[model samples]
Target: MWAAGNVSDVLAAVPQSAGAGNTAGGAINMDLILEDARRATEAREAASATPFDGTMEAEVSRRVLGTRAHGLEGPA
Candidate 1:
């Protein structure tokens, strides 16, 4: 039951998990579980710095992938 979706439960009232704190159930440790969310947030922040906009993607395709990507070339 302790999951990322449990934030509403955590905020609505004192989290039972906070008191549990890796000692009682051993099923979910909030500190360890939240690390994944932290990592994902960091990855998102890093990606935001240099997003894949279409203009750059097209240039890379033209320069690197070349006309091979244009399957119509064989027909035309």
Candidate 2:
């Protein structure tokens, strides 16, 4: 099935009716959700200004080489 369909199935299977007063405690809090979305958008925009290439690869290389590259090593 499609990804959306799978997500819908997973959401539907959650125990929405098992909480106190049959209310779904796991339901989305729109205010908190909106705040999170706003923060994520801001973070993405900030990150777009200073993009790094091969960041993960560089980290792995630092570990393997046992050298302090890209500030990955412990403080002096």
Candidate 3:
């Protein structure tokens, strides 16, 4: 999972059932997963925007200070 600007991303892999007939019939589709991720991201962004102040200065500062205290880069 990842969050950027006004979007979040999610990628998941579902396995095929072995009892469905074939044991090696599992498949992976990036396009479908990407679309789902985009939708979910948009939904989250919309929800967040409803109450956001349109600025993340405080949050960014807190993260930076915390990182400095820990002697490491800010949380990613």
Candidate 4:
């Protein structure tokens, strides 16, 4: 558990509990990131997709920037 208040109260608290919890959370987050990357790679390969060529990338960027400038872009 996490707590914030008076300094003495905080000092008396068990800091290791938060440390252990955060360590567990970090591990879980890393596993999730790895799994997501694996899935994304699988999807890209299945699509027979290649990385965007420079011209195509530039066109997409132009359109996106134009839309944003015109306030036509949807919520991020």
Candidate 5:
């Protein structure tokens, strides 16, 4: 038991069995961490973007363009 209660000790306490590994195994791998972060961000962005977003943008563009092509129009 460490009286200092260092961060390394706390990290080491975690089991590798979990998805996140502890520093007890070895040095931290920045590449893996960055890759994991990138994957998480991509997944989050994909989940946040609903299917209707694309359709809504396309519909608005079409209406605006259609109105512009017409002789006169106040609202699309």
Candidate 6:
């Protein structure tokens, strides 16, 4: 876990925890993006014959956005 603040006293505490939280979240998101890109590349190569209907992108966007909108707080 990432934490930033004074360990000894309350008055001495410099609030950097929120920045730490953002860094941690950004790291996780970058990792997910890299993994998804790799998988997408592999899938694209393997799916040469698959026809693309423009709606597929919209459908996928909707599903992912919906999941985010609802807050995926629990495990799948």
RMSD of 1: 10.3
RMSD of each: 10.3, 11.4, 15.6, 10.5, 11.5, 13.7
**TM-score, per-candidate, Cα-based:** 0.29, 0.29, 0.31, 0.50, 0.27, 0.44
- The best candidate in terms of TM-score: 4
Looking at model 5, the pairs that clash are: none
Q: What lDDT score goes with residue 24 in model 4?
A: 64
Question: Mind giving the per-residue lDDT tens digits that candidate 5 earns over 1-76?
Answer: 2122244345543353332333323334565688899998888778866647887767877777775544465474
Q: Report how far off residue 65 is in candidate 1 (Å).
A: 28
TM-score of candidate 3 relative to the true fold: 0.31
**Candidate 6, clashing residue pairs?**
none
TM-score result, candidate 4: 0.50
lDDT of each: 0.60, 0.54, 0.49, 0.66, 0.56, 0.63
Clashes of each: 0, 0, 0, 0, 0, 0
Cα-lDDT of candidate 6: 0.63
Candidate 2 positional error at 55, Å: 3.1
After best superposition, candidate 1 residue 66: deviation in angstroms?
A: 28
Clashing pairs in 3: none
Q: How far does residue 23 in candidate 5 sit from its true spot (Å)? A: 14
Model 4 whole-model lDDT (C-alpha atoms):
0.66
The TM-score between candidate 1 and the true structure equals 0.29
Q: Candidate 1, which segments miss by more than 4 Å at Cα?
A: 1-28, 49-76
> For candidate 2, what is the TM-score?
0.29
